[model samples]
Target chain A: MIPVIEVKDVVTHYGSRKILNHVNVDIQPGEIMVVMGGSGSGKSTLLRHLIGLERVSAGSIRLLDQDIGHMSHHELTRFYRKLGVAFQGGALFSSMTVGENIMLPLREHTNLDEKTMAIMVRMKLEVVNLAGFEHLMPSELSGGMLKRAAFARAVIMDPALLFCDEPSAGLDPVVSSSLDELILQLRDALNMTIVVVTHELDSAFRIADRITVLDKGEVLTIGSVDQVRASTHTRIQDLLNRRFEETILDPDEYLARLTGESI
Target chain B: MEHSVHVQPNGHIVSFSGEIDLENSPAARTRLLEVVEYATTVFVDLTAVTYMDSSGIASLVEAYQRAKKTNVAFVLISTSPAVLRVLQMARLDKVFTIHETLEHAQHAKH
Candidate 1:
C-alpha cells in the first residue's frame, strides 16, 4: 500500500542555520504517527513542512501522492480541503461561536446546504463530547473545552489526513488522556492518517502507532514505543528519562558570541 | 454517486452506488426526502455504495426523521461495510432500521 504522506530526504534552514537535516518519514494510511522531540529539535519545523506552512530548502514532501512544494497557490488552497490541522494553541476565532468556527471550513470550501453543514458541525461536536456547547464563544470555554472545540473544528470536514500539534499540551492529566482517546477514536472511526507533533511522552505513548524521535534537526530513531524505550542511544534515553544534558561550548565560538562577532 | 429508484409493490426502493460525499450528498438528500415525503414506505439499498461520508449519513438521518413524523416506514437494506463502520462509530446503527436482505426488510414492520 502507498503511504499517505512521504517526506524524502527533506532539508530545511532558517537563514544560515540548519533546522532539519535530511529528514525522511513515511506515514501509512489509518495510522497515528507521533513526532516527538525537545525544544529546537526541528519536530515543529517538520510539521510546518508537512502541512505546507513553509517550503523545505531541499528534497520533497508528498502528501496524499502530491508534491506540495511544486503546487501553485490556487492549487494548494484547493488541496488543503483534504487536510485538517489543529494548532497547538487552540486557534479558534474569538469573534465567532464554537459552531461557527467549526463550520468556517465548510463555508469556505464546499457548496453543501446550510442544514447539512449545521448537522456536520453538531456531529463533530458530539464526537468530541462537546455537544450543546456550540453557541458558546471561544473565551467562554475552559482550556480543555477549547482544545476539544479545536479538534471538532479540525475534523468538521472529515479530512483524509489530520495533523495535531501539541494536542495534549497545557492540560491536566485526565484531560490530556481524554484527548489521546479522542485521537484514537477519530482515527478508528474516520480512517484518517494522523501525524501528531508533541513532546508529552505519556500522550505520545498512548496514541502513537509509531514514534519518530528528533534531536538537533535530525531523526534520531523511529520505532514502536517498546523499541524506542529499549534503544541505547544516549540522546533518546535522555529524552525518555527526562535527563538534562549539560552543554559545553567551544572557547573560540563562546568568545565570538560574547563579543557579538561572527565566527 | 449514481442513484436510481425502483417502484415495487411494497414501496419505492432507492439504490445508490459509487461515493456519496460532500459534492453529491445534497442531491442524495433531496431525492431521499422527496421519496419519503410521499411514499408510505421506502427501502434504501446501499449494497453497492462503496463510500459515504458524514454528509451522506446526515442525509439518511434527516430522511429517517421525516419518515418518522410522516408515519412512513424507512428501512436500510444491505449497508456496505464501509458505510456500516461509520454508522456504527456514531452509534447510529442502533437508531436506523437495517436488514441484511431485501426479503427481510420487506417482511419487517416499523
Candidate 2:
C-alpha cells in the first residue's frame, strides 16, 4: 500500500512535558485512519504535529514525499494550501457565508473565476447534503450541518490529505452517526486520505479503516477494527471499556498541586 | 429576540437584545445588509444580547462582507463572554474590529 503520511520516531514536548515519545504511524493512501485516545493522551498534539501546525523537537514527518518536519515556513505555507483541516469548533470564518467559506480554499489556492468558484462551492455543499443552503451563515446551521459544512470546506480544494479534529464532538447521536456515514462517503466519493483525531468510540468504530490507539503519548496499538477490539492489552481494554486506572499520587506532589506550589 | 438598525453620524449602529440565533439571524442579516449598502461605517452593538450561536455569527460575517465590498468600516461591540468566546473560536476576532462598548466602537478611528 502506498503511504500518504509517515511519522518516524516523532518525539514532541510541551515545555518540559513529553507529549509524544518515539511515536510512529503510517497512513496509507485513501484510507481513513482514526486516532483514538482519552483526554491528555496527546492525540490532538499529534494531529497538530502531523499537519505542520506545531513544530516537533525530534523525528521526521514526511507527507506526500516532502519532509513536513523540516520544511521552511514559506514551504510549509505553500504545502498547507494542498491540505484541508476541519477543527472541532467548525473553524469556519464567521464573517463569510457558507459558500464563501467553502470557496475560500479554492480562491486562495486556485485562480478560478468567480463563476467557477461559485460552482465548485455549490457542488461540494451538495455532496455534504447542504445544497441550497449556501446563503446561510455558519451560525444558521445545526450541529450536524455545521460539521457537514466543515467537511465541505475541508474538501473544497480536493486536498490529498484531510485532517478532522473531533468531527462528531458536541453533536447528537443520530447526527453524529450521519456524520460518520458522510465521512465514509467522502472517502469513497473523493478518494481522499483522512486522518481523524477523536475520542468518540462509536464514531471511530464506524468510519475507521484502521484504528491507532494512543495512551499517554505512546502508540498502544495500530490494527484493524477487529484486531483492536480483540487486543489483550490492558490499556487498550481499559480505553474500550471506559475504565480508568486508579492514579496513585505521591503525597509530596499531591500537596504541592493542592497548595499551588507546583508552579 | 429584538434587533434594530440605526444610522449614527459616525456610522451605522445595529443593536441586538435577547437571543441572536437561528430564529432571528435571517432578519438580522437582512437589516445589516440594508445599512451596509450606503453606510460607510457599521458597528454592531451586541451588549444586551444574552445568547448567540452560529446563526448570529453568520449575520455579523455577512455584514462584514458587505462592509468590505462597499468600503464601509465595520466593527462589533461585545462585552458578553459567551459572544466573545464564539468569535474567538471562529477566529473572527482578527477579522472584525471588536470593542467592549458601543462608545469605543463609535469613536474607533482606526
Best by DockQ: 1
Q: Which stretches of candidate 1 lie over 4 Å from their true place?
A: A243-263
Q: What is the interface RMSD of candidate 1, in Å?
A: 1.1
Estimate, for each residue in A1-263, the C-alpha lDDT of model 1 and write its tens digit. Answer: 99999999999988999999999999999999999999999999999998899999998999999999999999999999899999998999999999999999999999988888888888788888999999999999988899999999888888999999999887766889999999999898889999999998889999999999999999999999999989999999989877222123266664664465867
List TM-score per model, in order.
0.93, 0.65
lDDT of model 1 at position A239: 95
Docking class of 2: incorrect
C-alpha lDDT values of all predictions: 0.91, 0.81
Native A-B contacts reproduced, model 2: 0.00
Candidate number with greatest TM-score: 1
In model 1 chain A, where is the ten-residue run with the lowest total lDDT?
A243-252
What CA RMSD would you report for each candidate?
A: 8.2, 17.7
Pull out the clashing pairs in model 1.
none
